[model samples]
Every structure is written in structure tokens, then in C-alpha cells.
Target: MRVLITGVAGFIGMHLALQLLQRGDEVVGIDNFNDYYDVRLKESRLQRVVDADTAGKFTFIRLDLADRAGMAKLFAEEGLDAVVNLAAQAGVRYSIENPLAYIDSNLVGFGHILEGCRHNGVKHLVYASSSSVYGANESMPFSVHDNVDHPLSLYAASKKANELMAHTYSHLYNLPTTGLRFFTVYGPWSRPDMAMFKFTQAILAGQPIDVFNYGKHRRDFTYIDDIVEGVIRTLDHTARPNPEWSGMKPDPGTSKAPWRVYNIGNQNPVELMDYIRAIEEALGKKAELNLLPLQPGDVPDTYADVDALVQDVDYRPSMSVDEGTRRFVQWYREYYKV
Candidate 1:
């Protein structure tokens, strides 16, 4: 299949693109290489992908999702068989500082994607949503069927909006759309803004690491490889209308139209302190602690109920937090020569 993957230089996007290319699929990747994080990291990831593609099954294009005209032209020419959109303004606390970034990248950019897929006869459209959409619910294990109308941040709201927008296209154009609500995704080549990256960096630098929520927060920190696996499975399994869906008691996860949502996460939730400990153990360096309160637009916990994903894809994430963290630290040390 010829697949178009947005945000190809991103952590998850790069992994997904490489996996697709390895499995004998033609992959076209696009990224603006924005300064939201370190552009050098993005470049390094893209370089790895290019080097790994010995079969020459991959193509990389520098493009922004917000450029409507450029997106339209690309879609017209690419003849895409499927699309995996992982691009967005990704940080929750960053949303509190710059809300417009979320609007431009998450909302307007998603609009262009929906339009592109609608016109190009794309068979499957799998995109990234967030576990943060379950904001203020206080649910032990956040489920796709749960109500997510009360998002705390603009980032979460924009993800929810993307789900709604995709449903519209699915209903009107018979486009098969699937939204994967990702939990705390972490691994090698992760964004510098993420907690795992920051914690690892501070520990290696002999600086104090800020432990948020006083190290009480628990997260279903999904591994990057597991996320890419779920994404590929969902992309293959084109969404279909839920025959048992009812209008009287509507399920937020599935629709009568070809639209569905699943939680892509490691079902195991790990405490923040334990996660930090893993980093310390991996690097053999104890971190100086600065215990801090949870920042705005942040949740105390996130545990994804991936039952829907298992039921549909017959797959579940199985990476332990310890193993995942060690791998991330290994990559960090090698990449930075720490």
C-alpha cells in the first residue's frame, strides 16, 4: 500500500514510517520541521529512517499541515491508499501558554487532512487522539466509551474536535476513520518536551528534575514500538459501522457510520516516582529532586482501558515500564554521548 504519514520527523511518526517501509509498503512522509522542539532531533530521526530504507520504499517531503493549498496539491498527486496523521501541537502545558498553536496545528491542520482524505478516495484514515481527552473524568481506567466532552486544555479539546470532525467525514463520505487515543507515549527519539526525555536529560546533566504532582501521578506510559504496532493494525482494519450501535444510548467510541476510537496504551499504569527511579537506575545517576505541583492542563493520572483495541485488533501493548525506560535512557546516552 502507498501510505502518506504526516509528521514523519516526529518520534512516533518516524517509527511508524520506518515500520511501514520495512514491511514492503511505499511511504510518503511530510513534516514542517517546526521549532516546537529541537529540529536537530527531528533531522536525526529522519536520517535514521532514510538510512534504514535500503529498499528505497520511502519518500520524505517537507510540508506543514496548515498549508491548505500545499496539502490539497499533495493529496491530488500522491494517490494515497491510506493515511496516518500523527502531527499536532503536542504539549499540554504548552497549550496553556500558546493556545493559538493548538488551533493552527491541531484544528485547522486536521481540517485540511479530512478534506484531503475525503477527496482522494483514501481507504483508511487513522489519526492520533489523546488520553488527555478524558480530562476531569477521574476514571480509574479511561475507556473509549466514556464521555470526553470536558477536556481541560485546548490540546485535549482540539483532539476531541478532531474526532468529531472525522465523524462528519465518515458519515458524509463513507470514509473509514479511526482515532487512537494515545496515552503517555515514550521511547527512543522522543520529543524533548516530554517528561521522560526531560527527566533523563536532567539526571545525566547532574541537575534537579522536577517531579510533578509530587511524584504521585500514575501514567500508562505506552512504548513507541507498541504504539506503532497498534497504529499499523488499525490502519489495516478499516473501520466499519457498529451494527449494535443505538441512537438512544449512543457510544462515544463507535458510530453507526464508519468511525471508531480506541485507546492505544500499555494497560499497566506506573507511578511517576517508579518511572523516575527506572531512569535513575538505567543511567546509574541519582537525580536531585524538585517536587512540584501538577502544572495547569495536566492530569493526576492516565490509565487507558485498551479493551476495545484488543477486541478489534487482537493486540495489546505488553512493554513493561522498566524495560521501556531503560531503552529510552540507552538511546539518550548514545545519542548525546553522555
Candidate 2:
């Protein structure tokens, strides 16, 4: 399969690209390499992808997703079999600070991806949505079928809009589209802005860690490998119309068209303090805590019900927070020579 992955320099994108390459798939990846976090980390991830391409089956292009002409040209020329759209302006708090960034990358850029897939005859389009889309809904285990019409942040709103836009394309063009609503993803090479990364950095630097929601918030912390596996499985299984779908009783997760959404998560929710304890145990250091209230646009908990993913893909996430945190700390120590 010839796959194009946008945001190849991103945390999940880089991991997914390497996995595909290992399986002998031709991968064409593009990333604008913006300064959302650290450009050097992005560069290093890209370099790793380049180095791992022993079969010379991987290609990297420095392009932004919002660039209409560039995205169209690439899609037209590459003859891509599938596309995994991972590029977006992530972070709920960041969206509040810079809402325009989300508009350009998540909204406008996603439009370009949909257009590219629509015109180029791409068989499958798997894009990243967020568990945050379950905004304001007090559901215990957030399901794909749940209503996600109320988004707290622009980031979540953009992701929801992407799902709607993808459904439109799928209905009109018969394009297969799958949106994976990812939970809290954490592992080696994670974005510096994420809680796990920030907590680790601060703890290692002997600084105090800000405990959000007074360490009461819970999240379904999923490992990186599990996410990549779910993505590959979904990519292999093209979206199909739900025969049972009806207009009178609509399912937000599935449509009459070739469109679907699934929650790719561990299905295990961990308390914020418990997660911090895992990190502390991994590093063999106690963290100085600055307990604080939850920030704006942040949810108190996120627990994904991945029943559809398990039933469809025959896969389940097995990594525990303890083991995942240990691996990440090991990677951080090695990478930083600490």
C-alpha cells in the first residue's frame, strides 16, 4: 500500500509512519514542522523515519496541510492508496490562546485533505479526532454513538467539524472515511506540551508539577503502540455503509454512506494523581505538587468505550500506565543523556 501521512513529524504520525514502513508499505509523509512544541524534536523524529527506511520506501515532504495547491498536487502525483490525517493544531488550552491556528490547520487544512481524497480516488481516509469532542457530556464511558454537538474548545469543535465534513464527502463521493477519536495518548517521543511529557520534565528538573483538577481528573491514557496498531487495522478495513443505519434514528458514529468513527483508547481510566505516581515510580523520584483547579476547556474525566474497535479490529490495548510510563522515562533518559 502507498500511504500518505500528514504531520509525519508529529508524535503519533512518526510512530505510524515507521510501523507502515516496517511492513514494506510505501509511505509519503508531509509536515510543516511548525513550532507548536520543539522544532528540534520534530526534526529528530523525521530523521529517525529517514534512517529507518532501509528499503528506501519512505519519502518526506515539508509542506503545510493548509496549502491547497501543494496538497492537491501531492495527492494527484502520489497516487496514494490511503491517507492518515494526523496534522492539526492540538491542545485545548492552546486553542483558546490562538483560535486562528485551529481554524487554519484543523478546519481549512482538513478541508484540503477531504478534497484531495475526494478527487484522487483514495480508497481509505483515516483521520485523528479527539476524545475531547465528547465535551460537556457527562457520560461515563464516552462512546462514538454519543452526541458530540457541544464542544468546549475550538480544538474539539474543529475535530467535530472534521467528522461532519468527512461525512459530507463520503455521502457525495462515496469516499471511505474513518475517524478515530483518540484518548490521552502517551509514550516515547510524545509532544512536549502533553501532560505526561510536561510532568516528566518538571519532575526530572526538580521542579514542582502543576496538578490539574487537584489531581482528581481521570483520563484513559493509551500507549502509542496500541494507537498505531488500531490505526493500521482501521486503515486495512475500509469504512462501509451501515446497513442498519436509518434517517429517523441516526447514529453519530456511522452513516448510510461509507463513513464511521471509533474510539481508539485503552478503555481504562486512570486518575491524574495515579498517573503522576506512575511517573514518579518510573523515575524513582517524588514530584513536588502544586495542586490546582482544572483549567478552562478541560474536562474532569475521559473514558473511551472501545467496544466497536475491539469488535471490528479484534484488537485490545494491553499496556498499563506503569509499564508505559517506565518505557517513556527510559526513552527520555536515554535521549537526553540524563
Candidate 3:
């Protein structure tokens, strides 16, 4: 399969690209290498992907998703068999600072992706969504069938908006669009901005770590391999119109159109402090904790009900936090030459 994976320089995208390449799939990936956190880190990830090309199986483009004309040209040229969109301006706190970035990337960029997929005769479009969409909903183990209308943060709103837009395209053009709402994902090559990475770095450096929600938060921290596995399986299964969908009692999750949403998560929520402790234990150090209130747009907890994903794809994100953190810290130390 000729797969176009956007954000191939990202943590998850790079991993997925490696798996796709290892499986003998021809892959074309795009990433603007935005300095959202560290462009160097992104470049390092890109390097790994480029280096792993034993058969010259992967090609890359330094393109921004917001550039419609640029993306349209690539789309017309590639004749893509499938699209996996992982690019976006991600970060809830950062969204509060620059909301326009979210609009540009998550909203405008996603629109371009949909357009490209539609015009290119793509078979299936598998895009990244977030568990943040289940904002303000005090529900345990959020299910795909649940309503995600009330997103607390701009980032969450953008993700929810993507699902809606994808459904519109699916309904209009019969595009098979599947939105995967990933929970707290962490592992090797993890983004430095994420909690697990930050905690590990801080603990090792003897820096104070900010414990959000006064360490009362819980998250279903999933490992990267499990995430990639779920993605690969979903890529094989194109979206299908829900036979049980009714306009009279319409479901926000499933559609009369060829649209579906699934939560890709561990299905096991762990406390925030425990997650920090996992990292601490991995590094054999204790973090200087500065317990703080949960910031605005930050949910107190996230638990994903992946039964629908398991039923559809027969996959689950089951890596324990301790084991996952161990892998992450090992990678961090080696990657940083610490």
C-alpha cells in the first residue's frame, strides 16, 4: 500500500512509519517540523525514520498542512492509496496562548487533508483525534458512543471539530473516515512536553515538578507500540456506514455516513502522582514535587473505553505505566547521552 502519513516527524507518526516501512509498504510522509517544542527532537525522529530505510521504502516532504495549494499539488501527484493524518498544533495550555495556531492547523489543516483525500481517490482516511474531546464530561471509561460536544479547551474543540468535518465529507463524498481519540500516550521517542517525559527529565535533573490538580488527576497512559498497533489495524479496516444509525435518533459517534470514532487507550486509568512515581522509579530518583491546581482547559481525569475499538480492530493499549516509563527513561538517557 502507498500510504501518506502526515506528521511523520512526530513521535507517533515516526513509529507508525517505521512499522509501515518494515511491512514493505511504500510511505510518503509530510511534516513542517514546527518548533512547537523542539525542532531538533522532531529532526532526530525524522532521522531515525530516514535511517531505518533498508530498502528505500520511505519518502518525506517538509510541508505544512495549512498550505492548501502545496498539499493539493502533492495530493494530485501522489495518487495516495490511504492517508493517515497525525499532524496538528497540539497542546492545551499552548492553545490558550495562541488559539490561531489551533485554527490554522487543526481546523484549516485538517480541511486540507480531507480535501486531498477526497480528490485523490483515497480508500480510507485514518486521522488522529484526542480524548480531550470528552471535555467536562464526568464519565468513567469514555465510550465512542458518547457525545463529545462540550470540549473544554480550544485544542479539544479543534479535535471535536475535525470529527464533525470528517463526517460531513464522509456523508457528501462517501469517504471512509475513521477518527481515533487517543488517550494519554507515552513511551520511547515521546514528546518532551508530555507529562511522563517532563517528569522523568525533572526528576533526573533535581528540578521541581508541577503536579497538576494537586496530584488528583488520573489518565489512561498508553504505550506507543499499542497505539501503532491499533492504528495499523484500523488502517486495514475502512470506515463503514452504521447500519443501525437513524436520523430520527441520530448518534453523534456513528453516522449514517461512512464515519466512525473510537477511543484508543489503555482502559486503565492511573493517578498522576503514580505516573510520576513510575518515572521516578525508572530513573531511581524522586521528583521535587510542587503540587498545583489543575489549569483551565485541563481535565481532572481521562479513562478510555476501548471496547468498541477492540470489537472493531481486536486491539488494546495494555502497557503498564511502570514498564512504559522504564522504556521511555532508557530511551531518553541513551538519546541524550546522559
Candidate 4:
């Protein structure tokens, strides 16, 4: 199968591209490599994909999702069999400073992708939605079937909008679209902005790490491999119309249209302090603690109910938070030479 993966240089996208290539699928990866974090890290990830022995199965293009003309051209030329739209302006706090970036990328850029897929005979459209969409909900385990109308941050709002937009496309064009509400994805080649990376960097520098919400937050930090696995499975199995779906009592996770949403989480929420302890254990050093209140657009906790994922794809993200953190710390040390 020929697959087009947007944001191919991104943490998850890079891993997905390699997975596809290794399976003998031709992968075309597009990324602007914006300065959301360090472009160097994204470049290096792209290199790893390109440098692989199966690299001949992969192609890289430097392009932004906001470029409508270029995006259209890509779809027209490539005639993609399927697409994974992972490109977005991805940070909760940063969205406060640069809300326009989210609008342009998450909104407008995604609009272009939907248009392209709808017109290009693409079989499947799998997109990245964040667990942040479960904002303000006090539910113990976040479920896709639960209500998600209240988004505390612009970032979360944009993701919710993406899900809505995708449903519209699916309904209008019979497009098979799947939106994955990813948990806190972390592992090797992770975004520098995420907690795992920041904590590791601070611990290695012997600097104090800021414990958000006074170290009271809990997150279902899903490993990159698990995320990639869920994505691949969903990509292969195109969304189907829900036979039980009714407009009278609609399910947020499925519809009459070929659209579906699922929580791709580890189903294990770990406390912020415990996560930091893992970092400390892996690095053999304790972090100078700087406890702070929760920042805007932040949530108290996130726990994903991946029961649907398990029942559908036999998806079980079994990596313990301790093991995942240790691996991340090890990678951070090796990558940064700390």
C-alpha cells in the first residue's frame, strides 16, 4: 500500500513512517519541520527513517499543511491510497501564546487534508486527536463515548474541532475517517516540549524541574510504540458505519457516517510525582523540586479507557510508566550526550 503520512518528521509520525516502510509499504512523508521545538530533533528523526535499510520505500518532502496549493499538488500527484494526518501546532501552553498557529494548522491545514483525501480516492484518513479534548471532565477513565464539549484550552478546542470536521467529511463523502485521541505519548525521539523530555533535560543539567499542579497531576502516558501500533491497526481497518448508531441518541465515538474515534492510551494513569521519581531513578539523581500551580489549558489528570481499542485491534499498550520513563531517560542521555 502507498501511504501519505503528514508531519512525518514528528515524534509519532517518524515512528509510523518507519513502521510502514519496514512492512514493504511505500511511504511519502511531508513536514515543514517548524520551530515548535527544535527543528534539529525533527530533522534527525527524518534522517533515521531515510537512513533505514528499507529507506528506498520512503520519500520525504518538506512542506507545511497550511500550504493549500502545495498540499493539493501532493494529493493530485501522489494519488495516495491512504493518509495519516499527524501535523498540527502541538502544545497546550504554547497555544496560549500563539493561538493563530493552531487555527492555521489544526483548522486550515486540516481542512486542506480533508479536501485532498476526499477528492483523491483515498481509502482511509486517520488523524491525531489529543486526550486533552477530555478537558474539565472529572471522569476516572476518559472514554470516547463521553461528552467532550468543554475544552479549557485553545489547543483542546482545535482538536475537538478536528474531530467534528472529520465527521463532516465522512458524512458528506462517505470517507472512512478515524480520529485517535492520543494520551501523553512519550519515548525515544519525543518532542522536546513534553514532560518526559523536559524532566530528563533538567535532571541531567542538575537543574530544578517544575512540578506542575504542585505535583498532583496524573497522566496516562502512552509509549510511542503503543501509539504507533494503534495507528497502524486503525489505518489497516478503515472505519465502518455503526449499525446501532441513532440520531436520537448519537454516540460521539461513531456515527452513520464512516467515522470513528478511539482513545489510544496506556489505560494506566501515573502521578506526576511518581513520574518524576522514575526519572530520578533512571538518572540516578533527584530533581530539585519547584512545585507550581497548574498552568492555563492544563488538566488535573488524564486516564484513557482503551477498551474499545483492545476489543477492536487487540491493542494493549502494556509498557509500564516506570519502564517507559527509564527508556526515555536512557535515550535522552545518549541523544544529548549528557
Candidate 5:
């Protein structure tokens, strides 16, 4: 299948592109290469994708999702079989500082994607959602069926809006759309702003690492490979209407239309302190902790219920935090020569 992956220079996008290329799928990837964190890291990821495309199956384009004309032109020209919409301004805390970024990228940009998929005869539209949507809902294991009307941040609200936008397209156009609510995704080639990467960097530099919420936050840190696998599986399995869905008791995860949402997570929540210990173990260096209060727009804990994912995809994330951290630390050392 020929796939169009937005944010192709992103951590998950790059990894997903390589996997698709390796499996003999033609890929057209696009990214704006914004200076959110480090453009060099994004460029390196794209370069890796290019190097892996020995069969000439991958193409990279410099494009932003917010550019309506550019996105329309690419969609009309590419003749894509499927689209994985992964491009968005992706930091939860950053949204507090720059709310407009989320509106432009996540809301307006995603509208363009929906229009493209609706018109282009794309069989499946698989997009990324987030665990942060479960804000203020003290549910133990966050389930897609639960109501997510109380989002704490603009970023979370934008993601929830994406799911709503996709469902509208699905119902109106019979488009098969699936939204994967990703947990705290971490592994090699991760974003520098993420906790794992920052902690590692600070620990190696002998600097104090800020422990948010006084090290009380728990997260379901799903590995990148696991997330990629789940995404690929979901992309292949085009969403279908649930026959049993009733309007009387509407299920948030599924609808009468060809739209569905699933939580793609490890289903294992780890405390912040334990996760830090894993990093310390990986690098053989102790981190000086500066305990801090939880910042605004932050959740105390997040745990995903991935039973729907397992049932539909026949896959479960098996990577433990310890092993995943070790692999990331190894990659970090090699990537930076530290």
C-alpha cells in the first residue's frame, strides 16, 4: 500500500516510515520541520528513513499541515492508498504558552486532512490521539468508552476535537477513521522535550532533574516500536460501524458510523520515581532530584486500558520500562557520543 505520513520527520513518523518501507510499502512523508525542539534531530530522523529506503519506496517533502493549498495539491497528486495523520504541535505544557499553535495545527490542519481523505478515496485514516484526554476523570485505567468532556489543557482539547472531527467525516462520507489514544510514548529517537530524554540528558550532564508533582505522577510509558506496531495494525484494519451500537446509550469509543477510537498503551503504569530509577540504572549514573509541584495542565497519573486494541489488533505491548530505558540510553550515548 502507498501511505502518506504527515510529520514524517517526527520520532514515531520516522520509525513508522522505515517499517512501512521495509515491508515493501511506498511512502510519501511530509513535515514542516518547525523549531519546536531541535530541527537537527528531525533532519537526522528523516535521513535515517532515506537511508533505509534502499528500494526507493520513501519520499520526503517539506510541507506544513496548516498550508491548505500545499496539502490539497499533495493529496490530489499523491494518489495515496492510506494516510497516517501524525503531524501536530505536540507538547501539552507548550500549549499553555502557545494556544494558537494547537488551534492552527491540531484543529485547522486536521480539518484539511479529513477533507483530503474524504475526497481522495483513501481506505483508512488513522490518526494519533492522547491519554491526556482523560483529564479530571479519576478512572483507574482510562478507557475509550469513558466520557472525555473534561480536558485539562488546550492540547488535550485539540486531540478530543480531532476525534470529533474524524467522526463527523466518517458519518457524513462513510470514511473509515480510527483514532489511537497514545500513552506516554518513549524510546529511542524520542522527542527532546519528553521526560525520558530530558532526564537522561540532565543525569548525564550531572545536573539536577526536575521531578514534577514531587515524583508522584504515574504514566503508562509505551515504547515507540510498540506504538508503531499498533498504528500499522490499526491502519490496516479499517474502522467499521459497531452493529450493536445504540443511540440510546452511545458509546464514546465506537459509533454507528465507520469511526472508532482505541487506547494504545502498555497497560502498565509506572511511578515517576521508579521510571527515574530505570534511567539511572541504564546510564549507571545517579540523578540529582529537584522535587517540584505539578505544573498547570498536568495530570496526576495516566493508565490506559488497551483491551480493545488487543482484541482488535491481536497485539499487546510487551516492552518493560527497564529494557526500554536501557535501549534509549544506549541510543542516546551513540547518537551524542556522550
Candidate 6:
């Protein structure tokens, strides 16, 4: 399959692109390489993806999702078979300061992606959603079937908006769209802003790590490899109208149109202190902790109910924080020569 993967230079995108390329799929990757984190890290990831595939099955394009003309032209010319839209303005805290960034990238950019997929006759459109969308709902485990009308942050709101937009396209154009509501994704080459990356960097540097919610938070931290596998499986499993869906009692997870949403997570939610302990064990270094209140726009816990995903795709994330942290520590040491 020939696929177009947006944000291909990003942490998850880079890993997903490599897997797709290794599986013999012709891949066209695009990213604006914004300085949301480190552009150098993004460049290195892109280079690694290129270096890994000597077969010339991968192509990288420097394009932003917000570039309407460029996106239109690329979709028109590329003859893309499938699309994996991972490009977005991420970070819940960052969204509070830069609300417009979320509007431009997550909302406007997603609109463009929907248009591209609709017009290009793409077989399937798999896009990134977020677990944060389950805002204000204190359910033990977040389920796709539950209502997600209240999003605490602009980032979460934008993600929820994406789901609605995708449904419109699916209803009007018969475009098959699947939205993967990703949990706390972490692993090697992880974004520097994420907790795993920040904790690792601080621990090695002997700096105090900020323990949010006084280390009371819990997260379903899915490893990158597991996420990539779920993505591939979901992308292959094109969205179809749920015959069981009823307008009388509409299921938020599915639609009468060819649209669906599934949570891609580790199912097992680990406490923040436990995750930090795992990192400490991995690096063989103790972290000086600064226990802090939960920042605005942050949730106390995120537990994903991925039964729908497992039923449809026969896949589940199983990597434990201990093992994942160990792998990340190894990569960080080698990459930074620490």
C-alpha cells in the first residue's frame, strides 16, 4: 500500500513510518518541522527513517498541515492510497498559552486532511485523536462509547472537533475514517515535552523532576511500538457503518456512516510515582522530586477501555512501564552519549 503519513518526522510518526516502510509499503511523509520541541531531534528522526530504508520506499516532504494550497496540491498529485493524519499542535499545557495554535493545526489543519482524503479516493483515513477528550467524565476507564462533550483544554476540544468533522465527511462523501484516541504514548525518541522524556532528562542531569498532582496521577502509557502496530492494524481495518448503531441511542464510538473511534492504550493505568520509580530503576539514578499540584488543563488519571479496538483489530498494547522505561533509558544514553 502507498500511504501518506502526516507528521512523519514526529516521535510516533517517525516510528510508524519506519514500520510501514519495513513492511514494504511505499510511504510519503510530510512535516513542517515546527519548533514545538527540538527541530534537530525532528531532523535526526527523519534522517533515521531515511537511513533505515535503503529500498527507497519512503519520501519525506517538508509541508505543514496548515498550508492549504500545498496540502491540496500534494493530495491531488500524490495519488495516495491511504492517509494517517498524525500532525497536530500537541501538549495540553501548551494549549492553554497558545490556544490559536490548536485552532490552526488541530482544527483547520484537520479540515484540510478531511478534504484531501475525501477528494483523493483514499481507501482509508486513520487519524490521531486523544484520551484527553474524555474530560470531566470521571469514569473509572474511559470508553469510546461514553459521551465526551466536556473537554478541559483547547487541545482536547480540538481533538473532539476532529471526530465530529470526520463524521461529517464520512456521512457526506462515504469516506471511511477511523479516529484512534491515543493514550499517553511514550518510548524511544519520545518528544522532549512529554513526562517520560522530561523525567529521564532531569534524572540524568541531577535536576528535580516536577511530580504533577503530587504524584497521584495515573496514565495508560502506551509504548510506541504497540501504538504503531495498533495504527497499522486500524488503518488496514477500514471504517464501516456499524449496523448496530441506533440514532435513538447513538454510540459515540461509531456512526451509521463509515466513521469510528477507538482508544489505543495500554489498558493498564500506572500511577505517576510508580512510573517515576521505573525510570529511576532504568537509569540507575534517583530523581529529586518536586511534588506539585496538577496544572490547569491536566487530568488526574487516564485509563483507556480498548475492548472495541481489540474486538475490531485483534490487538492490544502490553508493554509495561518498567520495560518501556528501560528501553527509553538505553536509547537516551546512546543518543545523547550520557
Deviating ranges (above 4 Å) for candidate 5: none
lDDT of 1 at 323: 93
Pick out the ten consecutive residues of candidate 6 with the lowest summed lDDT. 52-61
The Cα RMSD in angstroms, rounded to one decimal, for candidate 3 relative to the true structure is 0.8
Could you tell me every candidate's TM-score relative to the true structure? Answer: 0.99, 0.99, 0.99, 0.99, 0.99, 0.99
Clashing pairs in 6: none
Query: Candidate 5, 101: how far from true, in Å?
Result: 0.5
Candidate 3 lDDT by residue in tens digits, 1-338: 99999999999999999999999999999999998888999999999999999899899999999999999999999879999999999999999999999999999999999999988899999999999999999878798887778899999999999999999999999999999999988899988889888887777788999988899999988899999999999999999999999989888778989999999999989998888878888898888999899899998999999888888888878788888888989999999887
Q: What are the Cα lDDT values of the candidates? A: 0.94, 0.95, 0.92, 0.92, 0.95, 0.94
| Model 4: number of backbone collisions | 0
Can you list the residue pairs that collide in candidate 3?
none
lDDT of 6 by residue, 82-171 (tens): 999999999999999999999999999999999998888998999999999999889879999999999999999999999999999999
Question: How many steric clashes does model 3 contain?
Answer: 0
Lowest lDDT sum, 10 consecutive residues, model 3, at: 196-205
Where is model 3 more than 4 Å wrong at Cα? none
**Model 3 quality (TM-score):** 0.99
Q: How would you encode candidate 4's per-residue C-alpha lDDT over 1-338 as one tens digit per residue?
A: 99999999999999999889888899999999888888899889988998883547787888999999999999999969999999999999999999999999999999999999999999999999999999999977999899899999999999999999999999999999999999999999999899989888887888999888999999998999999999999999899999999989988888999999999998889999998898899989989999999998898999999888887778788899888888888888898888
Write one digit per residue (lDDT tens) for candidate 1, span 1-338: 99999999999999999899989999999999999889999999999989999998888889999999999999999999999999999989999999999999999999999999999999999999999999999977999999998999999999999999999999999999999999999999999999999998888788999888899999999999999999999999999999999999999999999999999989888999998889889989898999998888888999999999999999999999889988998898899998
